[model samples]
Target: MAEDFDLVKIMESGLEGAEYNKAKFPGLVYRIQNPKAAFLIFTSGKVVCTGSKSVENAHKAIITLANTLKDIGFDKIDLDPEVHVQNIVATADLKTNLNLNTIVMALGMENVEYEPEVFPGLVYRIDAPKLVVLIFSSGKLVIAGGKIPEDCEEGLRIISTEFDNLGLLS
Candidate 1:
């Protein structure tokens, strides 16, 4: 059984502690790296915790860490309530190279957008809020936005299933 750790209390205390020593600890508290990256570290006693890199990866890593702790018989210990995500990479690759324009045409451009920059790619804002379909010129496909790790896993599984059904891998 998961311990009932009041996340709110932990967050409030952590913020207070972090704010109290902001001068000595740069990037110790809440610091946004960009629109999609960040770092978070908060220590409460022996639980020295750190999570950085895209929000998605951070959550996954933290959950895995928590499970490991629990498995090691630290069920009574509550991890810090605040979840930190520092990086989120969105990319994908299909067995067959897909044309961005063609895919957009099939999916309709109303819900999708494309951009040009350091990492130029097309972004598909599907109906699902927690899901994003990213297509790149290098034949890399990325699926990001699964709020829960299971959701991400499901998404990948569904992709793989579809690929199998269509013999895309063969």
Candidate 2:
């Protein structure tokens, strides 16, 4: 059956507790904050993606997550289109810190219009709908505008949260 869901929500929410453990088993595993929404991806092409949400969203989330990994350049895995839903898990929002200016610099100024600040760092807009706040290497980002601050906050949050969940937070 075709899975139904807002892929962006699933991806955004799922990314909260997702992790990538290169040392543990040489692959990626997403331990969604929702206990029921957890899964493991082994380097050997074995996957155990389970969640207790609407069976449709659960399946959709897994596929969306899996595709995201692939897009992010994770090791190849033969994904089963017929994904199975074992349980549904409650959703939890994981906290994170994102430095938009730094990210923009990292991504290059070609994508943004750079503006100087007296406090240090830079500010820019994304697609004209989002305001990005960036600090020097030592500063944290403070973003405003857009549907929400997520676009700005997620970058840093993903790295830390993913590392933490992968048992590499230290």
Candidate 3:
């Protein structure tokens, strides 16, 4: 989070090559290449970090930003900022081809949406893990909207069990 950040001062400090264009975008886009993450720093002390493959990488990016700000004479930055994992996306392979039509019928209309002409995959919304899993005909699955890695794993397990019960696999 960018608490009361003076973007002008930060830009003048020349600590890092950060992209800031108030007229074009409200947030300062600071990118770190090591862990591969981009931080969107807004004037309202709101920061949104994205593109990190894992939560640890995200935390590293935030910490690095805070330290850089402090080193650049920005004193209001919190050394230990409160971090939260808003979402986690994961992918897996079921190892057997899926029949979208059959799986849709077995999983029920409310939870599954499959239109081959519009999309090649089926969108399966799972409630317990509170995430959406994309099931493809080639046995590929993409799980999204998970707060933690475990949530994604749990979602995969749940869906695998459901598919097994319905005999939808293969």
Candidate 4:
């Protein structure tokens, strides 16, 4: 949930290392090293936490920031701010080399984008799990745009199933 924040008050309250320069950036940047997350706290109280390796870590970081805000005497801060995972970028390996041209041809032209001249990885967008996977020739895949961590695994499973059906796993 988003609430309004007095950025000036938060700044003057000695929030260690919290930077708020309206001219440079629109929101205040609060960083935590333990969970390895950075938050863009806006005047509208919209907190965008990034750089956390996992969903649990991101939630922990947000709670840490909220507690910090409360300790700074910010009454409007919610101790339990609702966190929404926008995207989860993850990587996986198929353990076998892939021929981009053949895979692209078999995967169909509707959901695949393989512009070798523009980018080396083949961009494959799946509608089921609703995520994008970048397939490389070296069997590495970078799955992005997932709302949850499971989405990445589901995408990989879907890819594996498709490849298996097409006899491309070998």
Best by lDDT: 4
Worst 10 residues of 3 by lDDT: 1-10
Residue-level lDDT tens digits of model 4 in 1-170: 34788888888998888899999999998888988999888988788999999999999999998888888787767789888899999999999999999998887899999999999999999997899999999999999999988889999999999998999888
Superposing all C-alpha atoms, what RMSD in Å does each candidate have to the true structure? 9.7, 18.2, 2.0, 2.1
Looking at model 1, report the run of 10 residues with the lowest lDDT sum.
30-39
Whole-model alpha-carbon lDDT for candidate 4: 0.90
- As for lDDT, the candidate ahead, 2 or 3, is 3
Clashes of each: 14, 7, 0, 0
Query: Among these predicted structures, which one has the highest TM-score?
Result: 3
Pairing residues by index, what is the TM-score of model 2?
0.31
Give all candidates' CA lDDT scores. Answer: 0.49, 0.47, 0.88, 0.90
Per-residue lDDT tens digits for candidate 2, residues 1-170, read 12232323334455656566456555455665432556665544556765434555566667665665655544442344566433222222223344545455465766454554555554444453433434333434444432333444544454345336654323
What's model 2's lDDT at 6? 30
What TM-score does model 1 achieve against the real structure? 0.44
lDDT of 1 by residue, 6-87 (tens): 3344445433333324456522343222232223333432222333444555555555545534554555654644553322
Weakest ten-residue segment in model 2 by summed lDDT? 85-94
Query: Which runs of model 3 end up more than 4 angstroms from their true locations?
Result: 15-17
User: What TM value does model 3 have?
Assistant: 0.87
